[model samples]
Target chain A: MPENEFEKKLKKMMDDFHLPPSTSVWENVSRRLHEKRRRKIPFFFLLAAGLITAGYFTYHVSEKYKQNSTAAISYTGKNADKAGNYLLKDSAKLSTQKPGIKKEEKASVSNTLPGTQQKIFKNELNNKLITVKNSTALKDNSSELENDNAGNNKQHLNGQIINENNNAIVSNNETLFKNSITIKQPVTPADAENTLLKDEVQDNNLALKKDSISGLANQPGNSLKKSTTKTPVTINKTSNWQWGVTGLYAKSNLIENLTNLNIPSAQYSNDPLTSGNYDTAFKTTHAFSPSAAYAFGTVVKKKIFKNGYLSSGLNFIHLSVKADIGKTVDSVIVIPSPAYTYFVRGYAQPGFVKTNTSKYNFIELPVLFQQNFFHSKKTSLSYNAGFSVRQLISSSSLIYNQINNIYFSKEELLRKTQFQVAAGLSFEMNTGKNNSFFIGPQFTYSLSNLIKNPGNSSFHFINYGLQAGFLLHKK
Target chain B: MDYKNLVRNCLKGNAEAQKYLYNHFAASMFGVCYRYTKSVTDAEDVLQEGFIKVFNNLHRYRHEGELQAWMRRIMVNTALTYLKQNKHYSSELSYEEINLHPVSSENPVITLQAKELADLIRQLPTGCQTIFNLHAVEGYTHVEIGEMLGIHEGTSRSQYARARSIMVGWIEKRNENIKQRRYAGK
Candidate 1:
């Protein structure tokens, strides 16, 4: 068999051959392209709807957390304050009465007469015995009292009555002194009897005077002590358990600076296939506009020390960023390849105006330690430092290539999770009882790349925000 | 429309220009696909798929070569991909089978139309038909066909020879039938 005749004939036959295709082929291709375009429209609409729904849910949850926390704090504060004030007043009154009793006992012992000291001593000793017995009975009755107001003041009054018994001994010494001077003429039994009768009457008068003094002390002690004790309890309980809801708004920006790989200008221009002057410098300009961000969460703060607290909570955050990237290529080359014999092709050097808008949604867990530097009844200043672990729930990036007139969308390009460090300073003004309105300036710096691709231009997001919240302190 | 204008409009997503481009090139490209596939319906499927790829990748055409040739390359590549995916051609070949010759027969060359010749070529085994079409009609060397089909160059040569012998036998048998019909008419 010879190749010459067959090859020549077949070449001639195929060179002029043409076979018509069915019309339905173009219809199917057109329909598929239309379907592709239609597919993208609903995806964008669904994304927008999801974002709105999440935002609505976050708002209601934040509001509900704030109301519940505020009510719980106020209730706890009032109850604990009432209990603390009652204890403080009782302790103060007992402390003040102990000294008064000692002074009266010393006075009674020193003022006794020497001549009738023996007989006067017997009456004074009997009066001291009776006073001690009466004081013990009063103490027992006072301890048995159960009324909130009455029980608190009765213990103080009983202490005062015991002091008055010491005063009774002093009154007996005075009666003896007067009797000895007036009845100096005789040492008779009748004189002694008259003195005893007069002493008994004096003792009765002293008991009535002591009772009036105790009544006077009880009235003022209850009124004056109640007012003084309440102020300190409120101030001391400021660092107790607290909860709050912060609505956050932030201005976010990316730190993007890409290192360009420089190739020699002469190398590109001297190639025979290249037809243009080449620029050695390869520079990319990244224009970043301020991106809006929002976050809200319920935070629980437990007082761990006098001025320090530990806080943790679940926070939902939405961060959006827009970046315009511009790059110019120096030269374009055409390499004629025998493998792809139809076209002379090389690397495409189309200058692109790539505008990228990225939105990220995350549920974050923030663990923070806060310390109050300055605290007062009306205002407080505090600073907190913390780290947060954020799980990415959803993300989307829309990239527009102006040179190609193409729009591409990518979802979940970022990593599934990210970490960040945050620090803030808060200025809180006491707005009502156990409640404060706080405004804080907070800063967050990302610790890891938010995206999965390492070759993608590195983006470090620095977020600065004003955090406004209602803080409720527990007792 | 001119080639450059047609391509530029297609790049701009002009539906009319795309349909014009498809109408202009579908017949010639289908000729290329028809030679590679087993039937006209299979060829039509390949033609539709190839044009879709061409439209999608029009931006990469560069316009440095003839538009027909670029489209021809895409169609060829698409046909090869279809054959590989469908396993119409066996990838494995035995050395003993390549050496085996067709039994010789006494037949004369018969003048046949191109369509009849293509039908005779399609009658050969799938591997031989592909090698023969690539080497003879498409003007590719044994080395290029081997690279495309992932076989050795010697194997492509052997397969092309066998396809040529089979087609010659079919043409001889057709010519003998024509002689008998003439004798019966007498």
Candidate 2:
């Protein structure tokens, strides 16, 4: 029986397929893709949350402020005068309750008269913004008005006759004068609260008003502050100037899409020297670039359609670059070199991983055209689209030159300059009163080269990268 | 850290427990990820995602087996996902065509320095190394390796054999290097 040698090799090749253990593997693709390239969440989510929180706290504070205002109103200027008048009116009414024998007779009775009569009180309060002070005053007045029922009794004693009422008032003038002194003592502010509470026969409305007044006086702030207040006020401050930091990373052979001409080696070394089938135009050259960026932009807004504004500005980006391409890419991870075996012949693939680090500097300018998707008095989210231009002023690259039939180092490869174009989406978030932090990925493609050698070669530099930034600007 | 206790506590949703679990398993899992990845950043990406799966599936652990084994399974699956997405390793080569096979030898590449062996192993084409690891060390049958690596069993066998041959050559060269060094030292 003859076994086909080719069949055996095929069977063996199939058998050699090494499947890794079926465990959790590269599920982080979503996260990295999100970090590298993805659309941003609409600003409304955060904006809504912030607004709701602020509104709630503001409402709570406003309620507290209103309560404090009521307390303060009870203790001041026109309010004090109203209190005095109320007490005086009540004093007169009480004095006139009984028909007088005569002025001389009433004067003698004054020595035995009770002090500080209760009075009916009512002050004109603005209907628009009523406070607890008004409620207390009105409530106390009602209760006190009930106590005035005694006056009805007086009317019963002597039918509602004018001359008799005048007589009663003249006779009780002595009692009125005696009550006046005691009323004045209570209004002195120190015992005003205690005095208001103790006056049982006094009108309850008057007592309540006194209570609110004293309560306002007891506030922690200048409780005794003689300074008067009318209403609360608001203030605003303005400033403009937004600044931020930048980061950058650019490499010539990130994809290991080896371009550029490698010089042919004439000798050999311990390490294997690799070369492509010679192309006449291809010569050894170097290319290396890496960068990260920090950007800033100014927001210039122009009012356009009814109730709308158009906002746009100049975007400035700074990138940091570093390079050591051929060497770094070579040293990253050593691949497993295949062993000579009976099952396979002719050039078993040797494993190799290039760890190249190439970087340099560049600044980009982008003029973005934006449409305001959503807007408010203070902030907005705009969908921006425009052309971005990058200029390579200073940079470097690593050249893998074949020396003695082995690859070796060559530096300062970005001895020339280049340019590129970028286009992409940006998500802007208003971070403060006039500033914002925007980040979105942009796709950038290189349009030209960084070096110029006087020769003819078709070696091309092509790349597409996802760019991200915090859009620092004043709105 | 007591890894077992960490796994147990992590199941309870303690943040500290989760972090410890990550630190203990991340390195080896990264080794698995590196074997599958084309870039360090890509490997790191795999490492992050694999840990997330480990943490997420921790509750389903049921103490059925070793926690590390469960985590390893997740990492392998993660690496396979990368394979499914990229298919970058073995599009050109077929394993079934391999003519040479590695027979049992007294001197194997495993005896070489771990770093050097790793270096040698990484040199095999993407699909070949995967085949070698799956069939020779991991002990999956060729058929199973075929299904996981997306190749015919014969292709798997060929890639694995080619990988072994390359490793043996590297091992031989490294041995020569050591001998040369010894002679030089003497």
Candidate 3:
């Protein structure tokens, strides 16, 4: 290059010296873009197909849940006498927000009518109020208790116990209520009269008498009227959710065995794992996968259907497979092996066997039937049997090196996609609307081998896993 | 000048094209960030965060005449966030008490090698390096740099001119050193 021209060009380059990021970064990104589009080729169609299948599943599992439930509704003989009125109600009221302690005190008092529990709560409240008004020393303690009450109610499990102020009341009655309830002898008449008088004095300005509300079945015309504090009795709703989570272990073959005994390669290389040995040259193993699932969709629920949750979402899957690329070992013989023999070790043929490590990541979709027990109520035990499709997202491949740092010859390794059927049992959690977490165990059978193996199929290698997870949905 | 098209392309999710726009102007823009920050890593962080802001708010880019100026504003703001985060983590280091080294002038251009020029530019003690890049490469006025960096205008000018004069002096001394070695070889 000429000096002047070089200088001019150098100047231009100096004037425009911008460093761009490497092309490989973009190549990897664009490659992903193309792969994404390629995968999407069947995405909409599969989604539609899934929607229809899920719709059918959504329909029939619901029908099945109904069929199973109606048949099983009376499944539990806990009460053949009480029959359908089984009240396993999981309900709580927002009690602490009742504006005043008086209402709360009254409710407890009414429920006490002739009952020892009510008298105990009433005496506790009066002593607490008198203690609050009387002592300057106790004033500090009472206010402190009140402050502590509000904080704990907010932390209570059910919405009903949100009474922070109740803690102060409990603290005041701490010594009185802490004793055991079951007694060796009933209270004497004098003791009972004293308890009644204390209850009467405290009822000085209150409107309703405690006796009328007690023994609800015995309450006459005025009993038809409900007290403001008397909460509506809760009976568990028939629409219950099913959920569960599980962990799995699976072992499969990298290749399917060639069925024909007379085929050229079938008898040509006489290895018993190929012929009769259960241990094929290649082995696939999957370990420790946990998943949780829940079923929802109410038409089936209303009918007391067995299965109704049609679900789709992401699964963080870690799958590893080890491919042993050598002649079959002796112990795994499952084929008719008159022609082949197996070796525990040492090569029958002289070549380094190629071994490839496979790791897989996936997203799973399951459409299943969710069922309830004999009766549909607040909580139900449920199980699901469904077709599951897992899409591979990311995979890691391990390449082994020889002394020369050369890769083992692989005329193998790559194989077919999977079509699987999964059966699982889940414990459902329906806190509100469409929110839930399902925990359970699932078993999967791949109709199509991820890697094919043979000899009249040495027996099926299926995946056994546990699943636990949560999902978001429209209300 | 090209702000409208750049914002449009970025909003359309053209990543390669967006990266192109960043590369096209990041160094010159980085000089803007460096003027405020005390270190290269901080400046680079500010630059990255600034671009993230630019990308996220591309839709709000309403036909501004100077895209670089708009980006400069964001970079300045990002640098301020760095300062705030730094201040929150550690009480601001009181540079107020320490005196700055007085700058001297000695032109040292002729002795520079290609690799040495890049390296030396990289080494100008972050504060002066940035002022130098802004004045020499990015064509910013000292007043603009000062306003954006929150330094006095005269300080910006002095830092810029001092950065150049120091580079010239270093280059000259290097040339002399090379000459002495050559003579010794002979």
Candidate 4:
């Protein structure tokens, strides 16, 4: 269709037109960009906090259950101690009786004493028997008892009781002397007899408790059955260290700096048709398309606190870029002796670019902080963030030189080592007692440029992909 | 300010440079978006989206042609995408075959102000308004418009003609009203 004058006038009027957008549009754009930047901060702290919390909570709950069980067993020990004290008191009274009555009581108590069993029987031979006899003997002679009470016996009473009950288990080896019994002298025959009597009483009390438990188990009621079963307890503890193998597939791209791209004008033949087509091609910016990148690695994680973990891994990462390079014509040119004119050899045409891919491989070591955000009996969700150190292992890529109008191979253009910031979220499902499988999205961005000195051109690789792996819990 | 320096500074994340670039092109780009969209709010939305793409893809622009032209292309594409994505515009954008009629080719002088002219274009049916703005104002050919809108070339031509005929009628009516008032004053 031919252009009408009215359409031309309208086009000119529209071309010169202008209307200002509202100020809030800029505000919204700025705010979104700012938010995107803020979101990019490493999530290392959150991951670490979560893992540490998880580890600590697991440890604390187990310890608490252990304490409750210990308290229950100690209840029986207390009852046995009370019975031993009663026997000691009776021996004190018997000291005043006739020698015959004392002998009969001693023989009867000796007969009732149970056979020596476990080493724990020594716990029943506490110093209370000796203390009681000494105190009772002293009461008969008031002057001597008062002096003993004011001296070492008072220290023994205050310190030894605490050591025997609680401190002995918790105190370190260095504090052994303080927590151990410090009996200064040997026991007399009378004192020995009293100790034997206390042991018999403790044995009898233990036997009575065992009989009561059996009696309760024999009952038909649910409550009695529960009481008998509750006496024995078991605990399952969580592991503080884990090791896993992970793999990821993601879209990868390099962000290039465009300002430094110095594209020279296309040099073409004098043919008008050929120059016109080539001019349009030369004016267009070269475009590189990204391909799917992959990474595989093994990670080692250590619980740093109740809910956080510190993790590090060695990964093999592959990144690639594909560029469409057009068909090329190779020709030998001869120059005359008088005029020195250089011609660009091996120059590929602009518009006919087919698929030419460049590949990059790196050995990367990632240091991350992982945290468990949610957990259940069989599943958990955690997030991780940190940094990575990558060493380029190999590079095979085609470099386009616009000034010379040629293609060349150059691996030296890129830096050998690169640093990247990374973050991820993982959902883990425990498949067995000591193993779990986890999968999540992982994002990694290079902090340093790939090109050594790109002048105004910079290239940085960005990767985001799903990572799936299995971990073995170390108990 | 030099545009090369401005673009470089913007790429380096300079806030002042970015604001300066946006302020320099916001009005003209908003005008392009306004022509493509139905209302000011929608035009602003398209303008916002277009500027974001411009900033993000600024590296691809190798200083070829005018920077305003580059930005304007992005704005137009963004507006087209917005229209297709929006349910209201997409439904109105359906291109059905219309009866062919011979309309007068006589060119009447458009006496309306630019703002009035834009408002008059907006008053046309959504299909006619879009086709008129694209064909008459943006200068897209029927074949190109057909490919862009996923319609046949003949359908695009018919739509463009219908829009042009209607726009001519509205402009003629406005001019006649102005002439009547002037004659009464005389």
TM-score of chain B of 4: 0.94
Off by over 4 Å in 1: A1-3, A48-475, B87-97, B100-110, B176-186
- First chain TM-score for all predictions: 0.42, 0.29, 0.34, 0.45
lDDT of 1 by residue, A249-292 (tens): 99876554213322111112222233122443333333345589
Query: Global lDDT for candidate 3?
Result: 0.41
| Candidate 1 structure, TM-score to reference | 0.38
- The digit string of per-residue lDDT tens for model 2 on A1-475 reads 1023322332333223323322233323223323222112212333344345445544554454344423223234434432322232232333343232234323422322323334322222200010111211323332333233223222111133221111111111111121111111111222232223223323333222223334323432213222254221111111122344322222222212234333121221112222222322223323223444344544443322222323333444444332221111222222111211111101111112232333444444443344556554344455544444444444433332222112222222232223344444445566664356555555444444432221212122333333334434441
Give the alpha carbon lDDT tens digit for every residue of B1-186 in model 1. Answer: 379999999888788988999888888898888888877767876887798889888999998999999998899899888777543343422222387454233334647887787777777777787877888788888888878877888888778778777877788788889889999999
Give the Å error, residue A84, model 4: 50
lDDT of 3 by residue, A1-475 (tens): 1123322332333345433333333343343334444455554555568668766755665555333222111112222222221111000111122233345443432232212222111110111111111111232343443443343333221133222233223222111122112111112222222333332323321111122123221322111222233222221123333333323344322222224211111111134235223343422222111222222222112222323344443334455545334342222111222322211111121122444454555555555555533222223456767665555565553222221111122112222234457777767565544455556666665555342222122212245555555533331
Estimate, for each residue in A43-92, the C-alpha lDDT of model 4 and write its tens digit. Answer: 33433544566457546754653443231111122224332222223322
Ranking by TM-score: 4, 1, 3, 2
Comparing 2 with 4 on lDDT, the higher-scoring candidate is: 4
* Candidate 3: tens digits of C-alpha lDDT, residues B1-186: 566676777778787767777777776666556555654555565666677777667677777457766776687677656655553212432212123445443333354544455456656655666556555655567777777667777777667556666676677688889999999999
RMSD of each: 26.4, 22.0, 22.2, 23.9
Error of 1 at A136 (Å): 46
**Top lDDT: which candidate number?**
4
> Per-prediction DockQ scores?
0.22, 0.06, 0.02, 0.24
lDDT of 4 at A224: 22
What C-alpha lDDT, on a 0 to 100 scale, does residue A69 get in candidate 3?
A: 25
